[model samples]
Target chain A: MADRPVSDIELKAPKGDWRDAHVELRKGTFSNASLPKDLIALGLPNPRKWQPTDLDWQLPPDWKGILLRGMRERLAKYRSFRLFMDVCVRCGACADKCHFYLGSGDPKNMPFARAELIRSVYRRYFTLSGRLFRSLADARDLTEDVVKEWFYYFYQCTECRRCSVYCPFGIDTAEITIIVRELLSLIGVSTHWVTEPAANCYRVGNHLGIAPHAFKDALDFARDELRELTGLDIEIPISRKGAEILFVMPSADYFATPHYYTLLGYMMLFHEIGLDFTVSAYASEGGNFGLFHSNDLMKRLNAKIYEEAKRLGVRWILGGECGHMWRVLHQYMDTMNGPADFLEVPVSPLTGTRFANAASTKMVHICEFTADLLYHEKIKLDPSRNDEYVVTYHDSCNPSRAMGLLEEPRYVLKRACNHFHEMPAKTIREYTFCCGSGAGLGNDENMEMRLRGGFPRAQAVRHVREAHGVNLLACICAIDKATLPTLMDYWVPGVQVAGVHELLGNALVMKGAKERTTNLRGEPLAKETANA
Target chain B: MATPATVEERWLAAAATVSGGLIAAHTLTERDPFRNPIGHVLRRNLAALVREFFGAMDEAAIDAAFGEIMALRSIQDLSVERAVGFVFRLRGIVREEAPQMQPAEAEARIDRLAISAFTQYLACRERLADLKLNEQLRALGVARRRTAHRGGAPA
Candidate 1:
């Protein structure tokens, strides 16, 4: 535990004629070193020395040509990318909107400045004015330094699209970032943090590489926990064919803390409603780290979910709580790998509810599913079971911004807990901030950057903590479950973090169950412990 | 132009100039002065700092005001000189406006502010460094756990 909780507010001082110095520092367009071994392990095609600070990135002789050609190909292929390249006026609305800029004070971290890193290169190669009058047009030739800048700043972006929400032209900087990352990957310049997971998800059917039997063992372990907690015999169907629904979740839920409790929540909910669902060991992961790497890889990993759903002969897919997973599933999944003509649109078996929102994708969010059940009062909930916590929901960037899943989680929270408060309006829903470690940036090497980027979210969390005396920070993102605990421990100590379903697991009234004495973490309940 | 007939009026006019200077110094890098939250913070903190100089502002209030100012500035690549220099800007104003006020007394107050500002700025920088270190350690811990899971040496 930290000796004292840190606040970003205590560290500011006046600029006092120091703008030039700071501006010069930000213009360098460099990043802290990347490890060679991690890159090697990920099998990124390059023999370069991995350290960014070394300044010798060890690119191929034709690296400039490769990057330029890749950019040209993308300009023709993606109309959105080309339009984004053409439209930015640098009006500076997006300058302060980026959490990275607000946190790091690096001008390059500003969306406009970050775009210029690529736009400058785009101008020099693609535009007539840029080629003829380079300096005046703010264009520069593609060089090793420019390539290094791309590698550094492009990775800094989480592609949360908060900047787009505020942009007058409605330019999606996230798409621009995706294009740059795709262009960079052409020359085999990619981060190990991203590529490693993409490789793992490709080879082993999950990011963690948990084999079929191992995946079963994890489900079985959750079942045992359910038995011990609710004293109910819960059967977790593993790759069972002809099940009514196919459930897919981030593999982290099967493996990590807070998330595992959320997994328990799913089991308890399923058992309570007596719904038939199958968990697939084959499509064991819903998270596509390939979204962070390239679009093709995202499509490649996403194919498994539909394939597993089809093989199982399930009517529809029910996705668990995750961040980027939903972003791909909601926006890109159908277009990239679908027409899901084989699968039926999702409807709840117990509640007899049809999910019209998810009719096209044939996949329903577990929150939407649970929220429907609660709306009709199908499942009995003991709201007092979660009296121990005063909760605040963090709108995970991808889910809130990409999917507009703002209401469903809050509905679940309203039914599950007695006390709930929202973060400031500007920071939630469509304008939500990233977890600072999203899009495969959640590595130890980039921890400072993450902490800095996370400050806006943490600051809002702190506000509710101070104002409402809120203690538990509830969010839907699996990465939030793994990472926010660390972030809260550092930034807002005393604010415990949990998933919404973890609260649901606690509040759930199971049939013929013994008197519950503890919540999902096995920490004693207030009533039972007080009586004891 | 007509001059202020009284020393007190002259002092009040000079104080406005100092506060304006302080707010301007804080907002130099901000692209949108009105929309930026930090600009508001500077305006607020400069208001409080000016109050502390002329009014009976408590030590805690002074500290709280500086803390807000410091937090807004924390994002910048701040040096010790740049971080606390605004606190010293008042010294010149005090000497120029209220010469009747004790120079030693005013210098002492500025010195006190400089110390507070520097201490807060250092703490912020230290916390940033610590966060980076902690993140590396946490990442290493995760890596170690992964290694252990791979049937290698335990973390």
Candidate 2:
């Protein structure tokens, strides 16, 4: 019965990355002058000033027994929190795979080491022997300083869940990261990147901060792509009732440069199949970075989809190939959003086999839907259109491991391209690596961060391309668009990346469509500027 | 854009059409779904299937067809692990009835779905898999914390 919950802690600014401190440590900086004198020399705020030397710290009534205990109890029951507390085997194999590790060479960046930061605290607070006997697990004092460190490194992690694939015991650090972040949020600590998007999502339904007008224009443009490419009067139908499906996707697709082409693929394919689908402006975002940070935020972000789904009276939800977005649906949507008996299993029209768990509004990956359509004789092909070069595939991290969508895209690629070649070493299925930019690290503010993160993946791609003379990279994620080519230019110089949808669109020979304007090399030409 | 809808409504409509239409036509010397009870579950589900397969089905198609699947009660709520078999079987049924489907197209499509389904399937199977993975991670964290307390035990 812990009494007196600590209320009103000050929220400090972000420490950015522990890597900088880690680099300094490697240089033998901290331990060397950490002698109390160094604090005065460095002009750091002195503990002597902050500590309450005059009186004893008393617990506030607001922070007492039931409320705080109830919070802990509730958190302990959350899926990610519970799973985070119950699993993990500290193997360091995922060390080199982490971008922060490669970028900073900090021991703390190693996925296992980063997890160790919070796991140690959890042990003392939650474990049996830890609470009474602080003998072995030296649970550090839960001071304001500890809170500071938690805010710093926690945001540094993107929660990609890539490490879990290689763990012999299959420990997912991402889940732990989520739980820790949630705990931090409980103390009212906030990060600009995570909380800002979550707040924006609550207001505008997108992570990129696009207004409803811009959103409408983007949707119109996606529709225009369909009309131009298919030469059919296909509508980027919005809110049409009695519609068969709702293609709820990332608004980034509605706004970003290269990834928008993937949206074009969706528009073209829908026209070809005469499919009745519409985008819901209310819940259009597919990326759930908030999920990677906090379960509460995840629940908040996911709530919009259900609200929109009920409002529109639609059956199923289909996802784009964004990493965290798929992660939220595949991993946590059911646990959070349920009573979904209205939606039928997403049975592939081509094979009639149900997609994922059909019982709960079976969600399908865009790539899986596209590939399956091709597999069950649903879509015709014009593979000759992709004759310009040999193509290789890069499995987007979440779709590859978290969602199990690696093979579907490859199958579609093989049929759509005459010269398809698999990238070598840890490519495809579970062994696949990340796009170096999954989980929101792909933005311009994080450009240098993206390049630094994409190095190892770039090497893997280069090896395969050089060995096989492959020049084109077909990836199933938007994150790859921003990071891959930059990485390729630096490491693999000549290789390029494109979305699987873009490739399929290239191979799709629309019967009544006008002459194709797309180049054979398959790179998107300069954007047509509509008089802004 | 259209107003939003829940995964439940999406699936419920599809399930109702499939179950309702199947029930109605089960007795009639029936007509194929596309023509008969136009709103039949099979046809509606097929519409969803086609939309999902062809990668063009918009938000409305999602509500009509796979919305039920999106909203289907998770295996976590139920005592059995039937979503996997049901979904796969449904895939088979749609594959049988769908027209204009080509073998070469099916081959390519399955190839794509194989990786995504295995890696990112929204089916409860992958969720459970992720849970298992999460369990493995936390356990290791507990063990490490425990060992560190006992004077940092050797690996």
Candidate 3:
């Protein structure tokens, strides 16, 4: 057992001429199955041991019935789902827009083809032309093989909505992928990379399953590290009721590298501004892996934030640098679990600027908050402190596309760093390529796929690295912080990944603070000084 | 003796042949490295490999060049034979371009290079397999430590 590969699935390289043969469906590229414990904990069906390579998935007896009914239910429920199902002209506008398709050269990775995998089934089950004349109408029955294909291709999508940008009909292929994943979940088919973290988030209030005490310990460790770096006792309050604001960040900020530096920056910034904010261990996480899994799970996980906010009696929520966290907060949070009548519209206590945009959600992005502070000249900044890094910003997909947060992060980056360069205009802003590991596809098993998906982004980074001597790739997403380092190391070495706030934390000129010898990572501040 | 230009031409011919119909013509023609990474990586590394072969015969340089090529090919759908066969194609090019340059030594060097390519290929495959297990263990370890800190049993 130990001698065998961790997964029985093997990668099948395309045979003969690849264009002629078409890229074969590789078995292991799909993510690992959700563990029974996580499945049960999430109340997901069929809580049993299984692998994607397993011949028998041990699916529910009436999985086909369940799936058809699931399709019928969703089509009736979401107008966008129905419109998308009915809309795509298949003019192939989005065929070349996908990074996955471009990198893998797999025809199925194309957004339309991926959507067709489900749309075909949807037609066969629901539509009249498809019901009577299945093959003629390009409709296929919901066989196990079809289900398997849906699992393979749908998970391949990062749901970055890049394809939707190019579609003349504005067909959101990502919405199709999400609906297909929801259908898959009806029969107990899902990935551990997503489901496990989701279960952990549900059970322990964070994806890493860090309990309240451990969460506190991580904060305490960061507090100590901050003290060592700068001679200041930064206060990190947790679950302190009656605070004016509630601070929420992806749990990775506290637990993961490079991300931890961003956390330290937040601590320093909040301390400098003297903002009254409290962190809640119960709502310790901002990232909702549930967004990747299902809407119910997304809601269940997201509910904790507003619940914690109300309990702590904070004015409004302040979010940290995360991608999909912003997506759920911006697009879905208000509708799913909102009308936070208890909390006031967020007014930056320091800047006196109200976030009129977040009037309904009442949750302000950290970049917006900091950008406001910089614009008002409320905070002292030393851009030279980040002189060592030739920085470039990677607009994480959700923050850029879902929320249209294009300039705030870059605005903050320009003010915080001495030098800043952007990737190709096509690859930045709304058109930004995904980290290739988003939508819970960042599992180690899926490394090759992630590398392939990440190729375009890495290729863009490589260009800037050679052209501008850009060494630091800063972003505002925890997943990007966690995964871009691996991507950079693999494709373009010498380029480091960091959060925008980490750079800000380094350049922040805190009042009454000692001269800083090192940046937040505890490395020396200046390039020449470090070399010496 | 073959000039650097002639060696580079021969190398490009061999790589194009090895690529077969797998890579798109537009992708190969695309000048932007970001738009056509596979083409860029192939051109850069293959040129470096040939240069290292004729000039310094630097083992490390040859290995680094091979590593980049194989890193890509290993993930691709090409079989082991086709994946490493591109190395042997260079032997024919070397023979045709500079027949008088000690054919026997050149053939031996090319054979050794092919072996190194195979080794690199296997290493990439091994890395792919190990990635899954390593990631699982890493996550488990973090979870276990956190549980331990909370005075709970191993998760």
Measured by DockQ, the strongest candidate is 3
Q: What share of the true interface contacts does each candidate keep?
A: 0.05, 0.00, 0.10
| TM-score for candidate 2 | 0.63
- iRMSD (1 decimal) for each model: 11.4, 26.6, 10.7
The 10 consecutive residues of candidate 3 chain B with the worst lDDT sum are B17-26
Question: Given candidate 1, what's the lDDT at residue B56?
Answer: 68
- Chain B fold agreement for model 3, TM-score: 0.83
Q: Score chain B of each candidate by TM-score.
A: 0.62, 0.31, 0.83
TM-score of candidate 3 relative to the true fold:
0.88
Question: Which lDDT tens digits does candidate 3 get at residues B3-95?
Answer: 655766555544532223343443445566655667678778877877877777788888888887887777765677877887887676677
Ranking by lDDT: 3, 1, 2
Q: What is the C-alpha RMSD of each candidate to the true structure, in Å?
A: 7.0, 26.2, 6.3
Which wins on DockQ, candidate 2 or candidate 3?
Answer: 3
CAPRI level of candidate 3: incorrect
The DockQ-derived docking category for candidate 2 is incorrect
Tens-place lDDT digits, model 3, residues A398-484: 999999999999999999998899999989998898889999999777788888888889989988998999999999998998888
Q: Looking at model 1, give its docking quality level.
A: incorrect
